[model samples]
Structures are given as C-alpha cells and as structure tokens.
Target: MPKALSEHETEAFRERICDCAARLYVEEGPAAVTMRRIATDLGCGTMTPYRYYPNKESIMTAVRTRGMHRFSQVLEDALGSPGDGRTRSRAVRDAYIAFARANTATYRLMFEYPEPHKDDTAYREAHERMLRTVVAHVDVMIDEGRIQADAPIFGHQIWAALHGAVMLEIAGMLPPGFDAASLHTRTVTALIDSARPPAP
Candidate 1:
C-alpha cells in the first residue's frame, strides 16, 4: 500500500489543486472546472482530486476562500503600516490594485464569479474580514477628522470605485494611456476631499 501523505503534504497538494482549479475556472469558466479536468491538469488519476475535494463546488469554494484571505491580509498589512490616515488609505488602495493585477484570475474568482454557496462559512468570514478592513481604514480617517461620513457607506463607495477601475483594467476596457492606478488615485482623492468638513 502507498504511504499516506503527511499533513503538510496534504495542505500543499490542496493548494496545488486550488491553483489548477482557479486557472481552469478563470480561463474556461465554470463549465471547464470538472474533477476530471483538474486531475488531468495535475497529471493525477481521475479519482485523485475527489479524494481531496468532494465536488467541483467545494474546490471552487476553497479556491475563493483562499483568495479572499490572502487579499484581506494584503489590505490589512497596508492599513496597519505606520502612516497617517491619507497615507495609509493610499497604501490600501495601491495594495488593492497591485493584488488585482498580480492575481487577476483569483481576483475574478473572488468577485466576478457567481457563488452558489455564498453562505459558506469560510467564504463568508473571509468576505466580512475584507469588508471590515476597508471600513476600519475609513474609521481611522473619520477619527482623525480627515473625513466626516458613515463608515460603511464611505467604505462601499471607495470599494466600488476601486473595483470599477480594477475591473476596467482587467478587461482591457480602459482607453490608451489611462491606467487603473491613476484613475484610482484621482477618484479616491476626490472622494476623500468630498467627505472633508468645510474649512472654518
């Protein structure tokens, strides 16, 4: 009989499976992400992937959950960096764009892909963690009197703007010489300025 995989080996293999699944889903859409396809891509037996993941949906959930946690960490690191509110806000914005560009496929999976199991605990918690990171940054600005707006509302607005810019860049929809970074910077700065209290 074959020796069982060590716990670390098991986790490594799971990550490999998720990486393969994410690429297939991004490149060919959900229809292409079958268990057989994943196994074939990994050069394993057809049933090998099934041993690790019960179904395609579970694999996709794992992929998305992993992506969200990684994304949240990037944002959290930027938020936690030593800086004033405006500086830290820009850091988070830059980190958001950087992550999207670097992990376009995973980014799409996290936001663009339809989640049939939206209530899945891991995915939902990761989603909420990301949301809280954004709102917490906004709260920092508000506490410093940098802006006066509802944390959740302003957080959503900022998130919407950044996501729109990133999506356009990802889709190659932005016109020539108009990059997502510049657009993001300008839009976020304008939003922050708009929320500022009037000068006495």
Candidate 2:
C-alpha cells in the first residue's frame, strides 16, 4: 500500500499541483491543463491530482482564486503606503505592472480564463475584494479633491486602461521602441490630469 502523507505533506502536494496547473494554463492555455498532465508534471500517480481536485476546472478555480488573493494583497499594500493621492496612485500602478510581469502566465490566466464553476465563493470574494480596494482608494482621492468623478466608475476606468496597456505589452503588440513603463506612466498621468477639477 502507498504510504499515507502527513497533513503538511498533503497540503504541500496540493499546492504543488495547483502551481503546476497554473503554469500550464498560462503557458499553453486552458485546453492544455488536465488532471493527468498535472500529476505527470508533479511525478505523482495519475489519480493524485484528481484526489485533490475533482477535475481540471477545480484546479483552474484554485489557481485563479489564489491569483486573486495575491493581487488583493498587492493592492492592499499599495493602498496602505504613505502618500498623497497621486503618489498612492502611482504606487498602485507600479505594483500592478510588477505583479503582471512577475507572474505573467498566472496573471494572464487570471484575467483571460473563465471560471469553470460560477459558484466558487473563494474566487468571487477574492476578485470582489480587489475591486473594493480600488474603490476605497478612489474614495480617498475624491475626499482629498484629487478626483472629480464617481468612485466606482472612475476606478474601473483606471483599471481598464492599466489592464489594456499590460495586455498589449504581454501580447507583444506594442510598437517597436515603445517603452512600456514610460507609456504606462504617461497614460496614468493623462488620466489623472483629465480628472482634476477645473481651475476657477
């Protein structure tokens, strides 16, 4: 009989499976992620991954949920930094790109892949928390007279612009000689400039 794994070993093995699945999904897209493939990548029995995750979708959900939680932490750290509105905004923007660059595959999968199950509370709550963080930051800016727009609407607008730039960079669609960091800085600055209250 196979030796039983200790609880810590079981949890570590589960994380390894999820990490491998996440990388596969990011590198080869959703169709390439499978329970058997994950088990093979981890050098385990074909049934090992299935014992932890019922199917490929469950593994995907776990990956996505973990991504969301990490993302929320990034945003939270940015929001908590000591700074004025523009400073905080810049920190958030930088953090956003840093996360994407550091975890390219997982970041892409988080935004591009659809959840296999709609009822995954962990994924839903984690995603919602990230948005709420953005909204809270927007509220702070508005209170400081830094932003002149609806908090949620403006926050999502900023997110869209940042996401678009990051996606283009990831897809290699940006023009040759384009400096992504500079472009991102200019894009963010322009948006902030446009949102400022007009002078009397």
Candidate 3:
C-alpha cells in the first residue's frame, strides 16, 4: 500500500516527478528512469511517487500530455506579431525550438525515447488542436492560393522537419562550428521556403 498524497502533495509530487523524469531522460534515457529513481532524485522516500502515479508509464503519459499542452502555447505565441505567413511561420518554428531547448528532457522523452502506445485522449486532443491551429494558418495560404492544394501535408512537413532539427540540435548530433540560433533560423527559413508560395 502507498501513502496518500494530499492536494498540495499531489501537485508538488506531480511537478517533481516530471522535473526529475525530464532531467533523467535527458541525462540518461527513458529506460533508465524508474519511479523509485525519480523519488530518489527528488529526495522523496520510496513509495512517494506511487501515491501520485501508478507507474512509470503513467508518468510518461503525464509528461507527454504536459508536453503537448506546452507545445500548443508555443505554437500560438509564435504567430503573435503581424507579418507575412512566412515570417509568422518562422515564429512558430522558433517557439517550437524554444520549447524543445527549454524542456530538453520532456522533448527527448516525447520524441527520442519510446513509450507504450496509449490512446491518451488528452494528449491526442491537445496535439490535434496544435495541428489545427498551425494547419489553419497554412490553410490561409492555401485559400489565398499562396500554397498548393496539399497544404495540410505541407503544414505537417514543416513541423516534422522542425522537430528533427530541434531534436538533433538538442541531442548534440549537430556538427561543431554551427551556431544553434543559425541552425534554427536555417531550419525555419528552409521550411518556410518549401511551404510558402513565391512572392508576387
């Protein structure tokens, strides 16, 4: 039997578990992370995390959902300023990279490491909402005839490319002498170039 977590304890443990998992995932990998390990890392006694989550899978699920929710904010804020779709689109990429950089552990766990497939309705909904928001932006270009009929694919293409670039950069896969900001700018620029129609 596990000790019960109070309201404050729940939130605190939740955040702590996520933080510890993130650090561990980044430093090691998801396989190396355990509920007991997280509790240990956070200086909590064993069985503490179990009170909050049933197991590591649940923790990963929580992390994934939180990652998606955080990503939606990044996408929304990226398009804040008034600009051409191309520029605003880069803002979206920038926001995404920022999120990846700031949340390296979450980003790695969400992408690089593998987790069991679960329906995760909340994760799916948040991810879909993010996609729709971005696709809607691309749809504008499509409706204006600034993009091809397959603009939805273009939207995801840009997102996938950005994710790869951000992941590689964060994972230290990029070669030396390359500035991260420059790489980010190039990724954003390339995606925009490929996705956006030529200027009149």
| Model 2 CA deviation exceeding 4 Å by range | 1-12
Question: What local lDDT does model 3 show for residue 43?
Answer: 87
From the highest lDDT down, the ranking of the candidates is 1, 2, 3
- lDDT score at residue 22, model 2, on the 0-100 scale: 82
Q: TM-score for each prediction?
A: 0.93, 0.88, 0.78
Instruction: Name the candidate that leads on TM-score.
Output: 1
lDDT of 2 by residue, 1-200 (tens): 98999999987887787779889877887778888888888898899787788888787888788878888799789978998977887787778889998888778878886776657788889878877875667777889998698889988888887888888998888778764566677776787788999897
Candidate 1 global lDDT: 0.90
Candidate 1 TM-score, true structure as reference: 0.93
Better of 2 and 3 by TM-score: 2
CA lDDT of each candidate?
0.90, 0.81, 0.72
Cα deviation at 165, candidate 2, in Å, is 1.1
Question: In candidate 2, residue 155 scores what lDDT?
Answer: 86
What is the alpha-carbon lDDT for the whole of candidate 3? 0.72
List, residue by residue over 113-137, the lDDT tens digit for candidate 3. Answer: 6556446787678667766765656
